[model samples]
Target chain A: MRKLALICVVMVLAFLPPPLLGEVDSALLQDSVTVDLPEPPAPPGNVTATDNPNDNGRAIRVTWELSADDTTGMKNVIGYRINRAEARDAADSLWTEASDILPSGTTEFIHSGDGEEDGPDYFAKNYDFYYRVHALTADTFSVSAVVGPVQAKDNWYNTGVTFVLLFVALFIILTVTFVRIARKGKELYIRPLAGIEAVDEAIGRATEMGKPTLYILGLGSAADIATIASFAILSRVAKKVAEYQTPLLVPCYEPFVMTVAQDTVRAAYMDAGRPDDYDEDSVYFVTSSQFAYVAGVMGTMIREKPATNFYLGMFHAESLLLAETGAMIGSIQIAGTDQIAQLPFFVVACDYTLIGEELYAASVYLSREPVLLGTIKAQDWAKAVVVGTILAGLLARLLVDLDFIKTVFEVSV
Target chain B: MKRQIPMMILSTIGTIFVLAYFSPGLEELEKGGSIFFDVVACFAFFLGGSNLVRVHIQKIARHNPGWGYSIVTLFGFGLMLFIGLFKLGNPLGIAGAPTEPGSWFQIIFQYCVAPLSATMYSLLAFFVASASYRAFRAKNTEATILLVAAFIILLGRTQLGLVMTSWVPDWLSIAQIPNLAVFIMTSPNLAGQRAIMIGIALGVVSMSLRLILGIERSYLGSDS
Candidate 1:
């Protein structure tokens, strides 16, 4: 029985992956990296250790020296970390580490309460604080000589920061829940998005001028949200063109998007009672290479001289080039993209520009889909919650700064 | 029937992913949703690649005007695919990953693919300069404001802004063009960006809801 058990154990051990060894040497090394820090400097410039402005007698600010040897060249200085300790009993003591890292060659740092009253360096009524600094290098660590055995000051919020944190968390949770519930049946009213609103008129103008409408979908595949949104808007626009018996041409960079666009445009045509007018060849693939696609699009635009150009989907720098050429041709150019970096370019050259989220919203507004309306409403509620948080944070800062409320939270700096 | 089932699946999966963001205890579901999307996208690549090859092959067979370029494209595509798939010239042989160092696949990617992509991105530099020159003209009040803002931002990004405005006193620092530009971006520009972002979020929510509820079915390639 013992031999069988041993054999089974060996088999399991042999099959186990490297990570299951319970000896994560890499992680252990990374975790222990905190040991490497510079030595703490001596207290400097009127070290008036007193009660914290808001808390009870627990926290103190320790300002440090302009250490001359703190130069990085003479010694490879990584950073400085502050640590505090308090005495618990005649034989026992406790120490707690800080979270923040300050760069070397800095003159001052603030050391505060570790939240334990009876721990190391803490007296019955006053807390005695001791501090040490650690120095760090690429692979080595050194600790400074201990400082303090000094009384600590306390603040009020040093005890109550937890409640404040909890309140903020609860508020976010409630707001999000309320928003989701509210959105289920609510009607969201969105203002007319110009890029979407112009679709019909642009197509109408093209039809009247006996010119085809040119539409180019960028490099994004069908699964990209921007591409999906673009296709949704395209379907609406294509339907309008179909109803007016206007020609619509689509050039796509990604083959998946091209296939989807073909289907979408064909469906739109059919829904408009113009299934016969649907031309499969009108929706075709361009090059997959970014610039190659751009070149193909520019060539098409120049040759076709389409009266209205619709540049939609996720565009990059080619946004400006396409918009500029469209502007040069005096096409009723409308462009929409979610890329914030490319927005300014489109805004500059396009006749009507859909900036950022407007491209996403354009689809909902044009389609009037109920679920979209509800989701918009929910998003509004979420925004309201965000606004509330900002307001609350500001209010808390003001109150804390003014000492209107004693800082009871024990988080000391 | 052909598109309806796929559209339904798309709508269902899309909505589930959105709901998984906030709905209780669906972390794994969200991960699965992401994996689902990746699978779809991965499969879709075959479609894209096949289409590209088919188009070029047809063009070459037809002896089209761009047939030579098409042939080059086909050869390039085939070579890349073969090298990557077979792990050719890899230090670890066929068992080695394609992107591993010292692999022929890695060489082609580093030398050919990465440089070409970077070159394409670099074209943005020349395009931006040209676009700015053409677009930044004083035609109206709005245009004039835009032009001035553009100049300040452009100058601020370069070292000349500091050189030009470094003489301003500390009290009048806000009036310095560089500081002013920074303030405008951090304040007004950030505010505008935030507002647009909010709107976009709302729009996304609405779009997602429609997709989930099957209210927007036109993408299904049929109304019925």
Candidate 2:
């Protein structure tokens, strides 16, 4: 009985320090060090939040001002610690946990529990929540003031502004440029894109030979933009196949891309008014393992014996294997990729090849969706700006090194 | 409608994040966006892991080809989970902590998983050699130019370039083929790469904007 009593006493003693010795009083017990917390910066202009559409109680979005104090540099200011709480309570009141914490220079937060639903508990039951943000130092010893109680706002800006601006800019530039070229009677020169021009020819050859057109969408995910661009090219090819009444076989490496490609081909067929001819089974997943996927594609090329093959999207080492296999099968392969290393193989093995940016440009060239076309043209403008900047900067460097220019433009250091 | 809503959300969020990069006030929105992505990707890993298990289990049940490999995979999966969860063979014992490197899970990861992955990666060297031999042939002007460039780069990466080019005069230092190769790579090649990269970036931006505005419905398997 005495031994049992002694054991109980020891257990109580072990947990005694955990209870209120006023939560261990780390701050109080430590000598009042001369620690100074940088003052909390002002909240961003137009801070707003709204009920996350298609998400549970997690309101979305908050914006704030980056501190002007550290505009020159943020050596001391590490980041901001954003906190949330019920608006009805005081700032000091045990606040609800922060929805998100961001860097000191950051000014917005999009709080949504959509993907995080199965992960962390990010949402709260009460909609009446307020927000506050504090600056944190590099040492993580200091915190700043709380700013909040801003109600959720759902007002949206007129999105037509973007379209109007784009349309006006694109129309003016393209029309003027083409008109000038026409006036000059200088043939607006376009070097032959072997891949683009040969596309139809390859399909025609396949039709003549009574062989299927092979389409290999590389082992990249649907989320990859390159994969999307490849699908665009695939759409064009599929339509041609429908017109020729030639069989089109698309082998996909990703399950998600498989689903997307099937839909894309189906849509292309429907648009071509040959919906009944669309072969959904033609676009199917061929394992996710990169090498295995390549092997499957190679097998398809050998067995199915496609006369014309299109290997498109981001390729890796498998590019050579697929291209070589297609070449051996006597398929007139027209391959396109943004992957630079694979360009050489495609060029060597394929009849026509699209390299680098040409892959992305191919979709815009084919579809000519006014919006897509406009976007492509707009991108050209951005490219021009970069090119022009570099040229001008180099010229200026060669001529005279201006002080103001040096302050603003010097970036290498 | 189901797909439309998600597409709309994606477009809006993606656009907002892009804008946040430029505008100082919208910075928090971007941070939140990154956090959201991290959270989403993390959760999606679970989905991927579950799918992996499901596919293998189905294969085993069906007595499919490579079913033994599936069994091995599942065994590995279950064993790793058990070892990590229980912290088996931990020096600290059950009362202390997990993930202390002395644990069996850590041991297995260091001994088995890391080495296997590294070995697989090292196979790329052999593959590259084979690929180069098959792919590189001076068939035409373009091929010859590529071949020359390839030779220069390959030689420049080795000590042979130094030994071969040591006779080059100091005043005509750029005449050294290896140095010229380096210059070419850093100048013309980098410039071309940068230009293409810029175009790609802009293309991504435009495509993102389209997706954000719900203008690109092809991804959703819908016209509207």
Candidate 3:
């Protein structure tokens, strides 16, 4: 049979001596490597040097047209080398190489300096320098004409982010207008969120069950916006918890967040007139290591069996781990995060989930201050504008083949 | 006065930060701000470390419910700190990095912490399965649609889908499981995610404006 014969052949090949098998291929490799040398390739053309834009004056941009040999000619050009010097006729040995021979077909290089002052790569700003590129072959190279006397200087403003400036200006204008209206005693309507509505219910469940509520301000530092938003929600939760006199556990991942949470909780208890009952140990610092923190929280959840778990902050990969653990413990869980990737996991595991902007909206909605409401309304209008633009842009691209909107919003780094 | 002073300072510095993005002249100021935060974080780290020790010691002294684990935690924390601070068992001495290869700190991190973190992270695989099972159940109309889509995605990711639909004609290739899966992800899934991202971006801008303008202050604890 063909199968049996193929197996036999494979066994024979596998059992063959390694040297005997490699001999044929090794001969072919040697034949390939003993290639005859050719004349030097054509030199690269039109070398240019200019100060790099949008940076400190530490770099110069060098570019050249590809050699004829690299294109429609012999096609033997392997790569290019860039070099620079200060003098007009510096010795070939004195000119420092900018980088390792750049890979084949490279037409541009950002010749920059870094780290040490006395090193070969020490290119200072505001210096008149000359640059040249070499088109290389196997054994020979042809050099392009030196382009020189170009000085690098820093630009005070990054014109690349002009689109960003425009958007920020528009947003500020819209926000200020709405905020003034709101300050004039107008009631701005915000759609009710299920996650915000469930805050009281989840805490009430914990109160009725006589089990503590666990609040996790996730792994983000205090500077994170999600953590900042969570602080507002936590203040609201703490007020309710204090009024009900329910046991509350807040384990924080960052020390700064922990300190802030302590202040927030203490203030809430003072406001609720229950400062006497607010335990200092109620909010404490956990380990800073990610898994260690998760494990510690998991241990507490298993031991205490808290009736409600509120995870409201910037959770990372541990979103599902925390949520799944809570689900296993049969606790009512309400979670919110701005992380779009983690939303699906939270949606699956938690009883109530706040998706994306809802996390911020919850804070604004809960506070109900005129200015906050005004800002939220402004954000809504911004969203509507973006939606309309997306639709119009799609139509423009499809029917008219125009992409001006795309170009207008494109952010340059 | 206490709150208002800080609010005023926040507004001033925050406005500078916003301008710093577009103005290259403020680039150095931005880096300086970051360096300042790092310096503050070092102090905060000490607070977190001391709190860890104090909380654990108190729990151990009082014989709390999980006092046994506290001892292990303290011992591990103490050992790692001692080894790293002294650079003990490092091939390179004070001149080299504390985390030099074959050093006690690096060895423990590589063998112990890395594996433990990886083990915890790998637990996500099983959790995903369990969560997806609950999520993909056909309890409702939307759930049924999700289950079907998930089924297609699962098949398309493996060799089975190619074998299942390899004979489909070129004109009807879109009906192939792999192509269908790609369409679902790149079309519907991507569209939804982009919509959410736009909303999230707008929210961040609005929230940042509130902070910069001092419209929202509950984060400073009930001040709103």
Candidate 4:
């Protein structure tokens, strides 16, 4: 009877639930008591979305203030996540994750769509999009209020460049006013460049020695500004050479330059009333390769032993090579280039060096036209304005802690 | 008519480009102009190549001075052109890139042209020495200053500056040779360079305006 009773009790005990069993073990019962979990981070505030300015459209810039709980109170927030949707009242399922995970303290996200016309990720230009930022803890998230219905579209004009536009307009007005003033028969004073003075002397020396004057147009294309400026100088030089009846050798690195140079020499000869003396073969095309051109010029320098060498236009590493070779041959070297890095080499190796703007000024000095002289005067005035502005800005910053002058000149583009 | 047409075109295009900077819509005009220039330049290469051949051939035929060098130039030019055009030794066959690795053209360019270019470039070392010797003669006050600056810069680039200034105090560290060299470069030299750059920028702006307004016409030769 007792054994049967004990078996019945064991069967009843086996049918009991786990919680009832935990009552037998105090440690298990204590472990079963629920403990409160950490709260999710506070939602970020002042969320805003706008079309990204100065872009080709298809992008929105989302910005928000960081969450309060992100930096203080528990400081459990790890990062933030950005989400976007096409509909304003979109459900959580409809919201697409724009950013995977941004570190805490981040307040901006550029939600850009693929630039493709047709694609799954394509955000069509001029389309309205809504954005939300989620402040995240280890396991919980608190989302910000929906920012917008912001439409992304291209701007016809970038407002950020307003200051630059104003400055440019001012310059244009100043230049035109000065140009008109000079056209009224006012003689604009242009400081003489030593390089310009040397050009005539070099040509005269070449004529006296009865040796050719070698002129290298450098390795720039005809479209290059330096090369274009050089053409003006070359015309003047060719005219002088023609008047003196001295041989002029021009080795061009580009065919277009060669053609232009040929035409320039021919015209200069005609202008000098010595068209019969102009040789078509004098200004000829050399190999377009930089080093090959250098090699050819070096060979010419060695063989021809020119009395004067004129290194002008845009020169690169070969600047010193040519200048050194000319110096070695005991020829007077005159060089002019806009390349600043090559200036030191030319200054060291050549008898005369046209430093930076001096090249352009030398061209103007050679042309001696009223219009060109007017431009130089305008340029000088503009430079004066720039210098005054810079000095004023510096003094203001140093003395009064004012930055408005600096801000005025700050170019956005 | 010739001068007027060219001037009108230059003014129109220059104005368009300047306006394009402010208007994104007209940006394509700038790009299109650049593309047109590039295409024209590409076409000009044919003229350049032909002229090279013509000039060299004339020299060779007439037995002119340095005619032997003309033969070498022609042979090299012709051989390279033939190898590149035919895509000889190109693993991917005729349509492959002429400069593809393992190709005859690539081999020749890598082995011959590149080395020759480097050799020529290396000559600048010797040239710099010669130029420096002449320029740093200390003939005038400015030349003396330049010579001293160059010497300091040279010392700063070597271990000698560090060894010489190793005993300098922390307070006067900037007066040390290396530090002074750096100051000269970063402060005075940089200021001078910036000043020059500003002048160059202004010059470019003025020159561009003159070109656009048809005031600067020497670029168009005697027609202007």
Measured by TM-score, the strongest candidate is 3
Off by over 4 Å in 1: A1-190, A208-212, A244-249, A253-255, A276-296, A299-306, A328-330, A368-413, B1-12, B23-25, B57-72, B82-96, B99-115
Top candidate (DockQ):
4
How far residue B211's Cα lies from its native spot in candidate 4, in Å, is 0.5
CAPRI class assigned to model 1 = acceptable
On residues A1-413, what C-alpha lDDT tens digit does candidate 2 reach at each position? 96576556545554776565455435533322323333443333344444433222345565666654435444455566566666635656667556445665787776544225466654543446666655555554233344455433322332323443454355346534543544555443333466788888999999999999998888777667778878878888888899899998887776667766877898778767899998666776555667656655666687679999998898988887788778777899888887777777777677888876677767656654555555555556666766786788777877897665544443220
Question: What's the candidate order when arranged by decreasing DockQ?
Answer: 4, 3, 1, 2
DockQ of each: 0.25, 0.13, 0.44, 0.50
Candidate 4 global CA lDDT score: 0.85
Candidate 1 or 3, higher DockQ? 3
> Fraction of true contacts kept, per model?
0.36, 0.13, 0.65, 0.55
Pairs clashing within candidate 4: none
Q: Total clashing residue pairs per candidate? A: 42, 12, 0, 0
TM-score pick, better of 1 and 4: 4
DockQ of model 2, rounded to 2 decimals: 0.13
Q: How does chain A of candidate 1 score by TM-score against the true chain A? A: 0.54
Instruction: Find the candidate with the highest lDDT and give its number.
Output: 3
Off by over 4 Å in 4: A1-49, A55-106, A109-154, A274-276
Which one wins by TM-score: 1 or 2? 1
In terms of TM-score, how similar is model 2 to the real structure? 0.59
